[model samples]
Target: MTPASLTDLKAPAKLNLFLHVTGRRADGYHLLQSVFVPIDWCDTLHLHLRTDGQITRHDLTATLPPEDLCLKAARLLQQHSGTSLGADVHIDKQVPWGAGLGGGSSDAATVLKGLNTLWGLHWPTERLAELAVQLGADVPFFIHGRPAWVEGVGEQITPIELPQALFDTPVAVLKPPVAIPTPAIFGSENLRRDEKPAIVADFLAAPKQFGCNNLEEPAKAYSQEVVQALEWMQARFGNSRMTGSGSAVFAWVDTLSHQRQPFTPADVGVSDLTQTGPWVGRMCRLIRQA
Candidate 1:
């Protein structure tokens, strides 16, 4: 029997372990190479099936724009599948937006997944992913639900098993109060667009220390906060890099040294950072699946 409601669905955020712009297409889309992994931090969603054929969204924690991705995703699935069913989506937004964390994309993917079951469509992941890519470059990643090597304007995804050492490693993700517009960074004249393509074996050789985010230089140019966040993370963790486009930086925390203690935000003064402004920080770990 098809359930009328699917509650407490999780939409996990992703980190671009390293992002590189390899080239540009004649259409103006940039070719990319990156390793993407799901993180423990996520947004919670509750979906209720609506027989009246009306899709709606209610934000519980943070206010979302009227036409957020969740609404678009649900509507797309409805139109593509020609389903009479609609959904009432409730989002408990936790992951900060414009942080390069793929929060909106994850939420959209989760809505598609939830509605697939609620409406009894039972579409395969591949079929759903085809629709997902139409929604956003990052949406398909969440639909596929695994760590992947992404390329070709984010449409190409090849799932890979990460080393056990990195599977659950502690990571600190910090976001400044301001959001960096993705277009600003991508359109900047300073952006680098000719990085050498990297292979899976190359990344697997040193998963944690491999490669750099080609988007970082342009991002730093757009937002001084990005520079500050990167420097702040570097000061504490000794290594820091921007994820995806900009304004959010992350570093792998050294857990081996403090094996006796459980990881927390206080360990990295995240609370103090938050008090200083609207800075958002969390101690996260890599999740095997979304």
Candidate 2:
């Protein structure tokens, strides 16, 4: 008989308010500075703990590979903690893959956090975050569980609190029927590897225009879909920018009302999400940091 019941958890998506590649490490990893915020678009995770020491996945989408990040997270935690327990992971993926929305990294972070409790490890989040970085550049941010100022190849995180009005600022997110390969974007000859580092105070002073994404030119060169998405948002929402590397763009909505839910289509100038054919449109808000 199974000793534990199944648990359902959320793995939320994130948006990069601004991403700047300041330089490259001697080892070739790009150094970055950015503000990362969590959005309402999330993937659901169902986990069942097992004493049998066999990690498995019941994938709802065939698009995910057998060696996806979430499974890797579970195994990594199991090995480190020296826990004899394993997990059966079921994923209901909603965040579009390869869109620079940090879906896979978030999934991995959720798995690591979840397993710590389910396995009775009670490890501190700081320790978990240290482990998470090995999974991906974005994984530690999710484990930090806050909107953050990220630097140092995404290993350094500083949590920042935003005014509630910023949270009230509505956002519209759109993904074209395409994906951007992060490695290709990073490796492009056109990529900018030298931008002056930004100060948090300066960013807070003019939240919208602190740093430009160094990856946009290279990303747009490869994906016309990214160009189309940005153009569409700029036409409607007045100002638009690609979230991370490319393929998904977000625009600020001028209209603001108190919204009980994270997503409200009316807040984003969209009357309905279902009508946005071939484009995945979602209304989202910046979650309060942490």
Clashes of each: 0, 0
Q: Write the residue-wise lDDT of candidate 1 on 8-122 in tens digits.
A: 9999999999998999999999999999999999999999989999998876444467888989999999999999989899988899889999999999999999999999999
Top lDDT model: 1
Clashing pairs in 2: none
lDDT per residue (tens digit) for residues 88-118 in model 2: 8888888988788898899899989888888
Quote the positional error of residue 49 for candidate 2 in Å: 1.3
Model 2: how large is the Cα RMSD against the reference? 3.5
Off by over 4 Å in 2: 1-3, 256-277
Q: Which stretches of candidate 1 lie over 4 Å from their true place?
A: 60-63, 255-276
